[model samples]
Target: MSWNKLLCNLRELQLSGTLNGGQSFRWEYNKEMDEWTGVFSKTVWKLRQREEFLQYKVIGSLLQSIVQKKNDVEFDNNGVFEGLLKKYFRLDFNLSDYYTKWSEKDDLFKAACKQFYGIRMLAQEPVENLFSFICSQNNHISRISSMVEKLCKHYGEEICEQDGVTYYSFPDVEKLSTPKVESELRQLGFGYRAKFIQKSAAQILEWEGEKWFAGLQDMKYKEARLELMKLCGIGPKVADCICLMSLNHLEALPVDTHVYQIAAQNYLPHLRGKKNVTEKMYSEIGDHFRSLYGDYAGWAHTVLFCADLKKFQQTTDSEDIKPKKRRKKT
Candidate 1:
């Protein structure tokens, strides 16, 4: 159960994306085991336990694998955190300008960031982020997390144990592609999303190795997102979530209902009367934010969303704390 040494600033990983309390696709630390575990579908993947640089054991190799498999939904040892942080967060970028712009217009956004005590952002596995967001469509956070957890526990490989807790490895495409296995996910409360997961898994599994990797390579970020959308259950927003969280494409704008509301209220007041926001509209919005904020648009969005949620919770708390006036005698 003893890890070599913990990273002092480890919470930075959680800031890579917006994850509400008890949400399906967020990582949480296990205090007893001194490990960071991501729980999706009731299966836990030990993402990072100790400082890998300090402990040059299999843990370092494992961390690299999980981060490298960035855009692929299955959790593996594909990520290299030290390089990722240096390239992404610690380097020079206009964090102040974006924060100011977001704070100037949106009180909610400002409040949420302040409330969370400046958790940086969450960097999610590309494939899992993609599939998670797809499952999120017309769904609640609790249900989505539950479904993903089930998928991992049922199909993924058991990787390691820390303390008394065992972690499971995320399934690869081959394991998830089978219809017989995917159907069982419905029994775990995936409901209609079971078919989408199965079909997408099959579609990816059918691709030739180089062909699949090649498809992910393209200069235009939009192109990469579009390629993902061709699969079942992957819409524009879901694709963008994959791009931003997994592929490290920082400008990708994922407009869920929360984001849409935030945008409409803060930046685009005139976007009223549109039955459904179009891809073109999303593009324009994304481009404007990118131009205004530069490389960290996705991060900015995540921070703002988290800030908004915090504000909402604060308001609720304040109302609850207010005393009711005594009723006058009739």
Candidate 2:
């Protein structure tokens, strides 16, 4: 397979913000080389953005960790790679127009947009979104990424080997459904999430495979979430994530702990009077965004969420003054 290079306006597309912005977390950034290596669509590749010009190398066939002379497949200056990148990043959509419109809607959203300006929601694969969110329960971004990478390396087919390092694709649903897969994940420190991953895969298999997950894209947001809830470990939050990121449910708002705080501070200030937000409060927050931001509510909520995460990074990380309560994910 050949890969193509896409050079675009830096203001509209920034790899540091979009890739490192923390939506889908499979890409591994090599600081020394200034490159990011990751697998998507079952192909392993390397990319580096030089100002406006995006350079790439398609080191094909994930099944081989060690590559000889002939086995190496390369992609360059072709429609195949260009189409893939366009579809992956949703480049057809003009994000600047969205930013302008969203900023006009609310002052808070306006402020958040200013901070993480070029961040765009990625259209992740359904299987990857399903299992990745499964691993995300009771976990943070960094660990969630590690667990996802481990799942790929263990069950996925190897793509290629570079500098003694091998990259693999995300494991297939059938490959992940067996009893042994859950056991392997347990040993890999998946903890309680191991059960969720295996059980979810089993449920998908019972539904007659990929079409079950594919059909989700055609359904309404509430309906899709209900169907997703049938799988183990998928709650309102995770369901919303799968919907918004991959299933084209742009209005879905994943009310995680961070969003809960933002709601308490800004939109739902009545939440301050209570110890924790109830189900009613969660619905209120999601509904609030749905009403305010309209169609692209999910996209707006994502930038705000990332902005909130960035805010926490600048805060002091000491717990000496007072005891902290573990706020459950709403």
Candidate 3:
């Protein structure tokens, strides 16, 4: 099958890091194929990158039927899926320009950008983003991902299957709001988050239905965050996460331990050696980044957060080290 291409720079859209990073947890990389497959925006996508293009394949019965019929599908001609990809990836944003601006303003960001370019924030679905972060409370990426997959498998509608693997769309609020959902999720290893997921879904449905999330997009950053906090399991951090990731609030910075450490080490010296991040400290850290990075402080924070991750530590260690000189002895 022929692949469709979106003209993209590697420095602006590194698929490996962006897809598998903590923002969204659905993508799986195939080492042999040098590609990634993930379910998002209600469809499965297989993506890879060449020098200056992001190559993609839409994998599903409906899309594949159209592709087989057309033989060579041009995204320009078929706008729906293409548009979804563009919006989901926030393709309209010029990340390179932001990188330059951020690098000029902050030395730490400039340094981190050296190894962590192309870590753009994904505009994920709010429902998916909400539950995923609920699972993220005191959880690692691997486990959060596992719980998310279970949520889809058990409650979500099956979208399609490929190569013996089935893809499921994230469950809708109604589907997740069942009376038995909490118990079922507990049995499926969701732990305490089971109640959060179920109750939040129910609350959302009761308040204004599924469209409530769309309404959040139209709200100011603070307003949207306050609204999200009204739901079960959503606190300041998770609310900020949903706002930045889904509700079009780029300025919303979610301060977890990772972000707090980043701030203490490079920006806020007084925060160093603090045993816990108090509510006052959290607001202070967020305000500091907002002042430094402006409207897209959350976006900027994501880059530094990715740079600080242990998986990427090897690059930081090797690249940042300077070789010793021995020629003086000779």
lDDT of 2 by residue, 162-189 (tens): 7898888899999889989888899999
Top candidate on TM-score is: 3
Q: Quote the RMSD, in angstroms, for model 1.
A: 9.4
lDDT minimum window of 10 residues, candidate 1: 321-330
Candidate 2: deviation at residue 36, Å?
Answer: 2.0
The parts of candidate 2 lying over 4 Å away from their true place are 1-4, 62-77, 312-329
* Clashing residue pairs found in predicted model 2: 2-75, 3-75, 3-76, 62-158, 62-159, 63-158
lDDT of 1 by residue, 1-330 (tens): 233322433233333232332223445544454444454322333443232232212322244345447756654322333334334333234344455666675565566555453334344545566566656666654455556666666876665565675566556667778878656877777777788888888888777533673466544677888788888877777777677766767788776555666677777787655656676777767776677556767777667655555533422121321111000000
- lDDT of every predicted structure (CA atoms): 0.55, 0.76, 0.80
Instruction: Tell me the tens digit of each residue's lDDT in model 3 across 157-180.
Output: 788888898888888889999889
> What does the lDDT read for residue 276 in candidate 2?
61
Spell out the clash pairs found in candidate 3.
Answer: none
TM, every model: 0.68, 0.87, 0.89
Clash count per candidate: 34, 6, 0
Q: Give the TM-score of candidate 1.
A: 0.68
The local lDDT score (0 to 100) that residue 262 gets in candidate 2 is: 82
